[model samples]
Target: MTAEEFEKEAFALRPELKALASRWLGTPDDAEDMVQDAMLKLWAMCADLRSPIAPLARVLVRNICVDHMRRHHYTLSIDTTDVPDLSHGAADAECIDRMMAVVDSLPTAQQIVLRLRHIDGMSMADIAKLTGGTEVSVRKVLSRARKAVREQYLHKM
Candidate 1:
């Protein structure tokens, strides 16, 4: 892709890429950094990239976020502390906490897939690309994760 084409295709998706990073990293500031980093990397290899930069850019951003998490020893975390007070008739914090516990107890792949699908609202194909798994495998993992969380949460109650 030419530099102009790369800029149009890749830069147009900046907000989306940043949002993905924010969901993965848990902070918009860090998300911006990761997105910028990914953009630079993409720019370097822009000539080899194809059109519809969405898929490749998403995967690149995911990889960069994962690397950052690994280096910082971060796992997907749900900050229950910020959950609205249930006493005010907001969302059920206890239930959310219980579900989070169940999710955290799952295997790493399961947790990642579950959160990416349910929590981040990512599509199966996008999740597959980000996680380096086939869409069918991602669906299976997500199904199992959901089943496990439901069973475990009910058992706990």
Candidate 2:
């Protein structure tokens, strides 16, 4: 693609790229950085692009976001302490604690998949590549994890 065409395509997909980055990075600042880095790389290779740009842009954003998360050790840290005293018709603090405990009790794979899919808002394809699993496997794991979380935790609350 020509430089102008690549620029236009990149501009068109910038919002999507930012959204994907936001999902993977968790924080807005990190998401901005990921999007900027991905765009910079795409710009550098604009002259060599020979295929449709949207998927390539998404792939680039996903890879960069995963790399950033790995390099920075950005993983979810579940904290189950400090349950509030919701005795007088307030929110169910004890229920939240129970839910967290149930989530903690799940297998590591299930927990990771749940966090990456729900907490991080990543797509199944991206999660599959990130975890080195097949897309079907990722979907199954996510579905199982969600079911377990709902059945074991949210159902009680």
Best by the lDDT measure: 1
For model 1, the stretches where C-alpha displacement exceeds 4 angstroms are 76-157
Candidates' C-alpha lDDT: 0.89, 0.83
lDDT for each residue of candidate 2 in 28-117, tens digit (9 for 90 to 100): 888888889988998898888965788888998899988887898876986645434457786577676786788888999999898888
- Which ranges in model 2 have alpha carbons more than 4 Å from their true place? 79-157
For residues 2-35, could you state the per-residue lDDT of candidate 1 as single tens digits?
A: 9999989876899999999999999999999999
The best candidate in terms of TM-score = 1
How close is each model in CA RMSD to the real structure?
12.2, 10.5
TM-score of each: 0.52, 0.50
